[model samples]
Target: MHFHNNGNLFPLYLDIRYSFNAQSLVPFFAGAGGIMLDFSELDDTRIFINPSAGIRYVAANRTAMTFSTGLMVITGGPNARKSFINFKLGMELKRKSL
Candidate 1:
């Protein structure tokens, strides 16, 4: 799960992983869509959708390096619709498989 914020906009997402055993690599696709709750005003709430794809490389031990990119879209609220692209580089850890 991940959370991102920009001013009054808050975006949340979940990531699922899949592995290709033959190559010892993982390829993943995820959706970033969730309900936005704005305490300041109910009318300001919006729904968001973001989609992304990426690949992971296991370097050593239980650690891996990841690179991914995605697009973010939001709808609802008075002229509040917006869109953008996001790129990220990160690392993750997993139990070493026997």
Candidate 2:
């Protein structure tokens, strides 16, 4: 998902993240994504780079929580190059053993 001056844009994005300290209580990760934002007026295609870093923690009950923050560089139509910060939080629950 992408946000810019016009509004929200649903573009195809690909990103990869690397994590450190897999067995630790708290893990750190960094990732970067590439996306193309289309401009109808300018009739051009622009590539936006989104980079972020985050931390993840797993509780005793096997519930995981993650918090990430990144910046999205959007290059829209003419004279429209902006940068916005994006923050995301996620949670995951694991199933108990039988």
Clashes of each: 0, 0
Model 1 scores what on Cα lDDT? 0.70
Candidate 2, RMSD to the unseen true structure:
3.5
lDDT (Cα, tens digit) per residue for candidate 1, span 27-82: 87766678676665667677888788877878887788988788978788665688
lDDT of 1 at 34: 81
Best candidate per lDDT, number?
1
C-alpha lDDT (0 to 100) for residue 51 of candidate 1: 84
Q: What TM-score number comes out for model 1?
A: 0.70
Error of 2 at 54 (Å): 1.0
| TM-score between model 2 and native | 0.66
**82 Cα displacement, candidate 2 (Å):** 0.7
lDDT (10s digit) by residue, model 2, range 1-98 = 54545744556667787777766356565655555545443344555777888888875577888889998786745557778899989897888899
The CA lDDT at 75 in model 1 is: 83
**Model 1: CA > 4 A from native:** 1-7, 10-22, 95-98
Q: Which lDDT value does model 1 have at 54? A: 78
Please give the CA lDDT of all the candidate structures.
0.70, 0.69
Collision count of model 2? 0
